[model samples]
Target: MANIKLKGSGYGQFGGFTPYGNVTVLAFALATTALGAAAESNSTAAVKNGDVIELGILPTGMRLEDAQVIITTAMTAATTGKLGFVYEDGVDDAAVPQDAAYFINGGSLATAARLRASGTKLVVLPKPAKLVLTVGGADNAKASDIKVLVYGELTGPK
Candidate 1:
């Protein structure tokens, strides 16, 4: 296993940790070789409402720490809709996916500007993840590339 440590020193009551004198220590263990290799999964796709795209498949024993979704294409004022991320939990028996076992409710694409949603937590996908969008009345042409980045630990063989 590999480990990274950050050390600094010096602290002033009003200035916080001083760059020169006070001490601050940040350390973390990589845990396993596989975990160190699981940097993140990056998937990009042009998405529309009711469209399902698989982001990635997280190994069975790994734990997803966080996720981020960024709307690469700027949404126009005429574009109005909702975008979401869902991960399969290996339990639903329906032919069609209804309730997302683990989901991150992203911002409405209706915004008149680009959107960046990050730090979504408590998501663990033992299977795979898909993107779901509801583009209410937005112009289909306004839909563009969407990027999903999932961060996690892969403790088992991929």
Candidate 2:
């Protein structure tokens, strides 16, 4: 398994559109080659089961409304993933620990379809945090391309 960190705008904030007053959406996309790379270093390796892909970040005072995974290209059979967040270092709040599968848990990546959160789970970040995707199942290293869309709102006072 590897920890892949997508580089060069492979993932980042989705600009120009706010669903509502303070709501924003973020999008992360990766191809098989990108997913196979090592953390912070894009090497053409192979992703394995249990590989964790560090997607991007969510700012402080942001309420995570929902997350969706879109499989633009189908992955290997049985490949699955879980989307969640982990607070960055120095966060004062401890109420919210890292939830590896807060959004989609063991969701299938074997087919090209849109997968969303299992339930209405809302998380307000006490500080800046890293959004992540943990890949699972056999032959995940063979996955093609996929995208993750995150929706959130700035809860701080304007």
Candidate 3:
């Protein structure tokens, strides 16, 4: 589903064009090739010093417009690392997840600081949740193998 139409024209008072006509309709859906990646403790360990890892979930009726977080292996200072997203209320099967909803807040892995960061693409109609991707201030002694890549789409009823 893809339909975008935006037309505008209206300004009279003392400006000029005043015929009057403005239309805006945007609806974009259908995006899912099934791309995935998750890592925080899948081995290659080395994250400590304020490490809050999770990084996974969002498959049942997906709806994550876009997300990216990668730090191959470079975390000395980490520039106060932070790659975010959290909202998993599974009732009781807990494992450290109080509440979070960060869309790439305070993100930096400092190896030149630009490992990769993206989030913010949803003009409405984005539900079907269950997401967790956390990594804040990874210790420092060279943080260590952290990778998280979450791509979106699957707006229900493929």
Which lDDT tens digits does candidate 3 get at residues 1-158?
98988776332222234444222221211111112112323544444545555544554334344555555554556444444444454442243232333346667654533344444444211222344434455444442454455554443422
lDDT tens digits by residue: candidate 1, 42-118: 32233334433344444442445544455555443444444343445545434333333233443554443444333
State candidate 2's TM-score: 0.76
Instruction: Point to the candidate with the largest lDDT.
Output: 2
Which regions in candidate 2 have their CA more than 4 angstroms from the true location?
1-20, 34-41, 90-93
Q: What is the lDDT of residue 97 in candidate 3?
A: 31
lDDT order of candidates, top first:
2, 3, 1
Task: Give the TM-score comparing model 1 with the true structure, all chains together.
Answer: 0.42
Mark the regions of model 1 whose C-alpha exceeds 4 Å error after superposition: 1-48, 75-103, 110-124, 127-139
Model 1 deviation from the true structure expressed as Cα RMSD, one decimal place: 15.2
Pairs clashing in candidate 3? none
Candidate 2 per-residue lDDT over residues 67-148, each given as its tens digit: 8898888777888888988777735456766787888889998899999888565767877888888889865555477888
- lDDT assessment of candidate 1: 0.39
Mark the regions of model 3 whose C-alpha exceeds 4 Å error after superposition. 1-48, 51-60, 63-66, 70-87, 91-108, 113-130, 136-150
Q: All candidates' lDDT scores?
A: 0.39, 0.75, 0.42
